[model samples]
Target: MSALLQLSKLIDALSERIGRWASWLVLAAVLISAINAVVRKAFNVSSNAYLEIQWYLFAAMFLLAAGYTMLRQEHVKIDVILHRFTKRTQIKIEIFGIVAFLFPLVLVVIDLSWPLVVKAWLTGEMSSNAGGLIRWPVYAMLPIGFALLGLQGISELIKRVAFLKGLIDDPTEKKLAKTAEEELAEAIRAAAEGAKK
Candidate 1:
């Protein structure tokens, strides 16, 4: 029980950190794109460098945001049917789907991506695009993302196991799904802060 709580806390901290960093990356990408557009249109100066940077930034944002998205239970689910099931049934389904399907997929992604990243590193792979920015560093995000995802999946699986054992109550699905009110409130708060700044 204590171990599960400790792991949950760690995962939460990691998710928050990743989410913040991903947000910053996205903001940077937006700023860079805006600058590129202005420079090209106003100054008649374009940059292949800026275009390449956009793709790399987008790739990093996608990969780095994945684990945090999963942690928040924001991933799409076909829960139209699953929502009607009993708690015990839900647990069984999670054990089968997650243990048999989800975790294995994460492991396979991590396993395959590691070698791909290593080869990219060894060969010093670069974009074929002329005047492109650094590419090998972008390739490295694949393994790093999957590795973090795999770790978080393991942590979630352990928590599920503990729930099965009655060590902890399953986290309520209702609370997991944020209501529209919550979303609106968050948006309003953000807008207010932005206005102040």
Candidate 2:
């Protein structure tokens, strides 16, 4: 169990690093887009490559950060009814969901996409658009992303089981601070209330 916990920590670190790296793609995409727009409007010199690269970066960001999102417990959850249950029950349901749904879904996506990635790489597939980029790298993201997600899933399963076994604290508890949007919303509500008073 301790060995498995150590392995989970390693996986968690991998997901964290990859996710942080992937997050920079957002800034890169935005910069590219702004530059592309300026070049098109000012110089009337733009290529489909710029547009395609932005698209590719955005796709990569979403795909690569999936595991990171899962690790952070930020993925969408249908907790309206589930929240009524005890913590243990909630954790048990989560384990069941991860096993029954998450794992199988990841496996299927990787299985279906791996051949396509291989074919694209072998054929040297490029975008049909003039001045666009190669296709295989983006195609490869499916398996890579899902593999990362699967790894994170394994880590999460280990952590959750350890928690249940009284080996550690509750892994389901999110340790993050309030998001920027949440803070902003609170500020707005507070200002409104002050104004009313």
Candidate 3:
């Protein structure tokens, strides 16, 4: 159990690091899009490669951040009814969902996509669009992203089981940290109160 917990921590750390790095891709994509637009509009020059690279960056960010999202417990869930359940029941349901649904789904995606990734790489597949980027890098993200998601799912399962066995605290509890927007709003409120005083 201790070893399993350590494995869980490692997976969590990996997901966290990947997610943080992938987030930079969002800014990169935005900058690329802006530059593309500017070059197109101002210079009347455009390249399919630039446009395609933007899409690739977007896909990379979305796919790569999935495991991180799961690690952070930010994935979508219907908590309206779920919140009514006891903590143990909730954990049981999550375990069932991860084992029965999430794992299978990710496995199927990786299985289906692996061949495509390999084919793209072997063939050196290029985009059909003129001056477009190679296709394999984008194709590879499918399997890599899902594998990360699957690993995180396993880590989450281990944590949930550990919690049930009294080996750890509740794994589902949200960390009590303020978002940037929240912190800004709080600062504004404090400034306003100070002015009134």
Clashing pairs in 2: none
Could you tell me which residue pairs clash in candidate 1? none
Candidate 1 Cα outliers beyond 4 Å, as residue runs? 172-197
Please give the distance, in angstroms, between residue 119's alpha carbon in candidate 3 and its true position after superposition: 0.9
lDDT of 2 by residue, 109-186 (tens): 999999999999999999999998999999998999999999999999999998889899989778776653464457
Model 3, 19-62: lDDT tens per residue?
87787686678789999999999999999999899989988988
Model 2 poorest 10 in a row by lDDT: 179-188
Off by over 4 Å in 3: 178-197
- lDDT against true structure, model 1: 0.74
Candidate 1: residue 192 lDDT (0-100)? 88
lDDT of 1 at 50: 91
